[model samples]
Target: MKDILFVNSRFLSQEITGVQRFSIELSRSLKRILGEKVQFIAPKNIIHSHIAKELNIIEFGIFTGHLWEQIDLPIFLRKHNSPMLLNLGNTAPIFYKNKTSTLHDVAYEKFPDTFNWKFKTFYKFAIPHILKSSIHIFTVSKFSKKEIEELYKIDSNKINIVYNAINEIFKPIKIKNNQRYILGVSSLNNQKNFHSMIDAFNQIADKNIKLYLVGGINRNFASTKLLDEIDKNQNIILKGRVDDKELVELYSNATCFVYPSLYEGFGIPPLEAQACGCPVICSNAASLPEVCSDSVVYFDPYNVQDIKDKIELVLYNEELQNELRRKGFENIKRFSWEKSANKIIEIIEGLK
Candidate 1:
């Protein structure tokens, strides 16, 4: 087998989103299985990245983010003979050929209005070049693979499905139930559809059940409109960001978890919620149906009334809740970070 060198500059530089989490977890799993055969390479400038602490990272770039990944990283790769590079995030150096890149989604292209133009512009230019140049492409879901193929016109065989997985931190735990509240973990991005979710929750007759929103709730970069809409709501409690322990606790104690994302390459929170034994109600869009299977209560993402109805159904029906929880555990069985890591290695081997 050929040696693999993982490009982890993005993992070092970016915050822990689902993409970053997949990168870090897959790297960790790969390191355990491949041992010294797979080594990690990253840039010098770092953030509060938890994964770097656990892995032996060779950090050596002065530039950060895009500049570092595109310029410094490729130059560094050349110095090391450009060993087969594996990028776990969406972006990869277009000039590099002996590499595979994992793109989580095409939300930038699909919902351009949600992002600042800078983000949308960069991706619209970068992704096609990256996909064309990459030895193979890795994505989190079959839905994403198909989307990438259609958008980029790449052969379906060239893209692999490596599914985003529930972290080990998410497990069923016995926690004293909190006050009647439904939980939602998403960013303040427009695509997360929090506006629709909050509206839906407001329509529900159960005034006692509050909607607890978590993760990047107070992001300074978030859209003013989204922030204003969420801020005006009295029933929606914004939990800015919580550590894994706190998140697990919140999931365990919640009545049910609702994910009303308009689109996703692969949705992880619903899996996490299900792993923590919380019944899930997610949008029947994109990869949600693929990931959750028949385990989750489906609602139309665009319809506030549908979301409201689904939430109420899950809340009142104990039998439905029990059925979903049972199937959630079963659905989660299909994905594991270790299994995903092995699949990545298999793809790499085929590329070699």
Candidate 2:
């Protein structure tokens, strides 16, 4: 651990979302286990200042954006002669040699319609090179490991499967049940399938149920063109990015939680919904099945009608809801950020 440094480009370069949360939570967990052996470095311009303040991050880099990651990071690593550069985010310096990087998913390539051309094109070129160059590749799920191996034609042995756990913050709270709404949280991207969810919500016979989209439209990326579509639907409310406390409230008292993502590396929200004691209704495609297992009611992501049917079934079925809630409690015990952090250190030490 003497010559190792954790790269914090993604932490500074972007806002605190699921991805940045990964960097923060994992860093905290790793710090507890490894003590001061773990250190961090990032750029100066950070969006999530409160979260960043918690970590002992050395903020010094010439540039900020993509150039900071690609050029500035690698130069710093070279100057320090770092033995291992742990890149917790999906992208890393393509030139860095002795480093491990985590690839959350390859959704952009598989679902090009979900992303703008700029976002897609940058990843298409950067990820493959980053994966190939890294000493070890870490992914969030078995589904993602297989996807990366199949797409990049890399040896499966090189990619480590580190599961993403529900943050401890998402506990069941004794909040007043004022709202009877179905909850969905994700960036307003095409692959999130929020539009189809709206269509599905409209089909449901239950006139009383309202659908809430929790995450905001990401202005950093090209607009998903969903604001108008969401605006048109009266029952649908866009809560766009809430604080952790508010999010837990939304999760705790909802009638149900819905995750209609078309694809994911590891579907953390379903596990989150489960942890918060909300019954999960999610897509049967990609990593959702692998992550949620028997705990969630599944629907075909491509079929709007299928999503509708599943949501309705979960809504009215008392026995099914109770059973899902039980199984969800049992299922969440399998993933731990502490365990994940330990495994990550083992991989780094093993490669060394």
Best by TM-score: 1
TM-score of each: 0.96, 0.94
Off by over 4 Å in 2: 1-3, 219-225
lDDT of each: 0.85, 0.82
Question: Candidate 2's residue-wise lDDT over 1-352, tens digit each?
Answer: 5545565555755766677777778888887777667767787777766656666677767888778888777777777766578888788888878889999988888889777788888999988899889999999999999999999999999999988897888888867666678999888877788878887888899877789888867665524456776777788888988988988888888878889888888877888888989889888888888888888888888899999999888888889888988999999999999999989988888886
Which residue pairs come into collision in candidate 1?
none
As a TM-score, model 2 comes out at: 0.94
lDDT of 1 by residue, 71-160 (tens): 888888888887888988889888887788889999988888777778888999998999899888899898998998888899998888
Q: Model 1 reaches what TM-score against the true structure?
A: 0.96
lDDT of 1: 0.85
